[model samples]
Target: MSSTPGLSTTKQFRNLLLSDQLEFICEAHNGLSAKIVQEAGFKGIWASGLSISAQFGVRDNNEASWTQVLETLEFMSDATTIPILLDGDTGYGNFNNMQRLVRKLEQRKIAAVCIEDKLFPKTNSFIKGDAQPMADMHEFCGKIKAGKDAQSDPNFSIIARVESFICGWGLAEALRRAEAYRQAGADGILIHSALAVPDEILAFKQEWGNRCPVVIVPTKYYATPTDVFRQHNFSIVIWANHLLRSSVTAMQKTARTLKEQEHLLSIEDKVAPVSEIFRLQNAAELQEAEDRYLPRGAEDTCAIVLAASRGSELGELTEHQPKTMVKIQGTPILTHIADAYNAVGIKDIVVVRGYKKETVNLPNLTYVDNDEYAETGELASLLKALQSRKGRAQHTIVSYGDVLFNKYIPQSLCQESDDCVIFIDSNWREQSRYSRLGGFAECSIPNSRRAFNAKVYLKQLGNKIPESNTHGVWMGFLKVSPAAATLITTIITELLAQPGNRKATIPQLLQELLKRQQPIRVLYTVGHWLDINNLEDVVQAGEF
Candidate 1:
């Protein structure tokens, strides 16, 4: 554990941070530190919140100066070869400021950033002698939309961090925020450390992971192996602040080593080899993967729903804003979808706008303004959307913008041979506290042979099972094949083409599919599925 009083520029460190092999982050405390980290054989640099907050010499509040953050980001960008993910303290302010902050950061070529639910400079609720209130949920969601709207590259990762669990809020509250952030357009949910590593990992896996991919910092939380995380379907796992941990650990140990060992030479054996470190930094030629398939995605065929913080799920929470404007746990739900899709590779996306559109700014995402949005359902809003694809996905995904769920629905349904597939959860029950307060309820359906064409159990619409099990509407996710999408479009277009004819909702479209005998499949998602529709639910959605 020897150092020139700093992190080493060794091949091993480079390999860990660079090569995109591990999600380990080398944290840069300041602009000067950013350069040191990069030169010290690191691939990516993390701008930390706690460290940076301490620099301000004031308690963390939701009121840090933007100038400090902006300048620091600029400084970090200048010192690194790898991308720097800034810790955007609540986007440095409200919706407008948040937009500007993200744009400025993206312009700097920083690869990623995080927006926590903590009001910028917010004191931790869990930290003894540091209890404070956070930003209102609605305001925070707007901040999330603002950040997403401001980014140019859809791949530029935006992590929505939820701090409720760590800050004195209960578990139910935390889960509710996780659901909201997923719905709000966040690329992922960044849950903070509740305690030491193992307990934190257990919390993450148990709490709404099926809704989205969970990102974690092992240094502060659980110190489990990667394989354990992979088992729970965590798409991206970052061992955040490890470089910081190592740096400090080395200093402490080396000081003791020198004091205990009469000869400095005895302490030298603990150091990692220098030559191995340079190799990881690629001091030689960078090998090109000539045969590796250029990563391709099926973005060409689909509907891009330009989303806004919409509906009543936010209620008074969004009275001054939109539902997408409210914070889930810590981040807005809107940011969850943006990060989740971009991470796994769904780049071409459309976001239909209604409610408050000015609060969000995103590039490569087609925004369709819904003029009659208040009078129409998602199908009507979708009907107003414009597709860039020549033909829709043979498997088109009709995603609900305001409802937060995971991004894995596409992959799960893609492999299915069924002409039509719907991602469904058996938890489709009557409205719970979160949903009822959110103002949206899962649509009910008769659970019988009719829902599924079963030789094991078949019955006509009128012929019901004597003791049937009933499952209500979904958690708001769909993976429609092109044929099914086209059919739904045709069916709706034909119906709506006639004045006074009602457009078919997603459920209606499927009901018709049942009558038409189209083969349909449902992938079970018994995880958290809250229909976020109001302010009460905005804070309550997935407690169930």
Candidate 2:
């Protein structure tokens, strides 16, 4: 018989019991921990209520609420494809609550839930000792029946957790309650005990025989061998609360060590690295989502604008705002550049601001502050922004804060085939003097009168290009594909490690890529472009 995808986990879980081999279920508190359990070769997950509540620093007395547990289970369900058996404490209330909980769990693709026959707002068994009261057998059985009736998937389990052992009511009462729950439509029975040995569990399992599958959480009796569990005919074994406990211990040790030494060097090797955390968070999937759902004009592309410089040339404008914050016509120059990208649906914009950062505000844009702006150069600001986006963006555009150009230039750069595209104006030498006043664009091209101020394409600075080989002047804009961006970022990282190169310019970094024989594509455009250096250029920008 062919099976549908819906409730496939529930079906798999039911089959696990029928196979006669014990299923090992590990407890997980969050999605990341759930992935760890699956990667460790566990067959299924047991979403322990104690672990879930402790994750939020709350007590395990239903203080975290059923909704909170359901939310955590949803994350576990999304993080792994294995079956998740949730711990439903006292059915979260009564028969009506049990019905809702069953429906929600089934909807979330949970395989099963073990609801104990105890009073509502149940405390952890190991904590309250023998004082915990057990619920009436007939009424608790009705809760199981309601849960079973509400589940649309026949394989979705409602396992009855008997509290008789915890209440010191002995094996006879436990067997009787388990049988009653089985008659009321519980698919399995979870006989719990807080004893340090497995004798009570073994006796219950032996007397119960194969009447139904027996599930046990060997927390207190963790030293018992798997062979012992198998010999007792236990169908499933849960290692509950261990993962969260270990995490707490490791974290506390790290925190205490840091407090004593006041540094991270002592505990660096003992903890997991940030890269591993990134992998656990599935950052690559987030980038893919950005590529899929974000506006496709640039297709997973982003841009970083180096706007930290104060633009000392623009005298009065320097008094209040950063260079990019200077107004061109009625709007800020930064706003103009952002609008150009946003016009073509390029929404992932990161602007590095330093001088008067609070004054350069724009909606729907990310900002990173260059705290060392006064002592460092533009590359330092770029590094700050790029650091925030490492391994998160592939195709990116790097632009200067002072340049204003036709929006079509960026659109054209996006469709190129090469790893990097340098926007240049080949006609800069022939243009009138007013245009040159903006600043002479520079490249490695030697003896080129048009190459003067080295503002853009810093990655191409040190190479000496014959005037004849030079096609145009750098236009303060670049489109870097994934491969070239990675290389450029790597070179920048290496340079920043050197004491003298920490404040290296963008053009200097581009020159490193050029020296390494990285192919640099040039996009020659004669469209109206303005590089605002002084007040005259800002006026020219406003006029043009």
Candidate 3:
């Protein structure tokens, strides 16, 4: 995507190499780093061999296989629009290996490769600068020719890295190797050095005299000014390994601080927020793609929140506002639930309001009034919402307004394909404090230690289920398919026909569905939800 409209990535990279002005590139070892490099306004990427090897926890001695390095290059290529020049150490083998490497690089859309004239399993230049031996000149030239012939793209480049200076063979051998590689069809030359100054590079440039484009990696001589490279007319300067090194320093500090403090309080402001990570990962793009390509049913799922009851157990908290309006961390409980629903693409929300109805207003919600609030329970409110909507949604979510849960709960529930699916908190035993709050469930498989993917059906669900018979507690959230929505409307209409059943609850309605063999499935989660029942619950919700 970053490539010029008409030019290919290989051409873009070749242009940088042959440009009249000095060009700069930064190193990136992974997809994320490659994106970061692109974000920082770099024109190209130097996929550093040392950095890539270090990322895999291996020494930069070809310890990571060629295929493994190619896999990383694929990700980097996909993540950014810029050309990548890979540090292909010794072409990973001989002339045949060089040929294969070039074809694979083209497949991954890599722009160029810079292979050192050193033996296979080459040591890092800085590791022991003078100890490593250079490859035979004729054989290395043949490898360069093989790579050049193998490339399918005309602009795909091969920059021969001369190691004569690194091997203490000095400037004469470096120029000789450079000339031979250029004659063998190398697109450019990368004259490598590990000296603390640019004396050798400057001498090589002066004598080489515009024979071809030249590249320099000034890692050791970083203190030298950038203007020097520009003044000397070098083709490109690579700031290799700094990004990886800087990340290492930052991660080390963050890890040590976290281990010592045991909390994120001190370091929260010092690091990138989770939202920043989402932005860098281009999460919004995926959402847009889903909107364009996914089914309408997935996007059109509706939510009906039952918030009609006055939570008397909260004492004075519900005296002025409904329990769902109680603020936790400055956001109302109902707002949190609404946000969760919207996050999972459930935009058409209907809130059934009753107690302190005038105080229950929120943005972007259709309100259905349950005027007989004092005379009824959750079932009556649900009935009001359903009758108002007239069974329009293909899939509908029913939830209690006072419950606060992680967004993943609703995200997971939306993926269920069953006609009726009930969410049960299997960690109910650990959450004994909520046992008295009701909606205990009894499933066909009573044991909580079943296989993770085991199919379990709800046999009974109500406040009256005995503790010994209940497998878990319902989190007051359920999804209903179109058929189940129709079935529920019929059942609720029949039940509410009797005036005395006006005070019925949602759990009781679920019990009736089970008795009629409605085949409701259970979706079990551990603990990631809470309900506000009493004043103690208010305190816990704040912390939740």
lDDT of each: 0.58, 0.81, 0.89
Q: For model 2, what is the C-alpha lDDT against the true structure?
A: 0.81
Residues 269-380, model 3: lDDT tens digits = 9999999999988999998888687653447578899998888888787889988898888888899999988887788899999999999999999999999999887778
> Residues 399-425, candidate 2, lDDT per residue (tens digit)?
888888777877877766578777767
Could you tell me how far off, in angstroms, the CA of residue 71 lies in candidate 2 after the best superposition? 0.8
Each prediction's TM-score versus the true structure:
0.40, 0.64, 0.64
Colliding residue pairs in candidate 3: none
Q: Could you tell which candidate, 1 or 2, scores higher by TM-score?
A: 2
RMSD of 3: 11.4
Task: Report the C-alpha displacement of residue 170, candidate 3, in angstroms.
Answer: 0.6
Q: Provide the clashing-pair count of each candidate structure.
A: 63, 9, 0
TM-score of 3: 0.64
Instruction: Report the error of model 2 at residue 436, Å.
Output: 6.7
Q: In model 2, where do residues sit more than 4 Å from their true spots?
A: 1-7, 292-529, 532-535, 538-544
- Return the top candidate by lDDT: 3
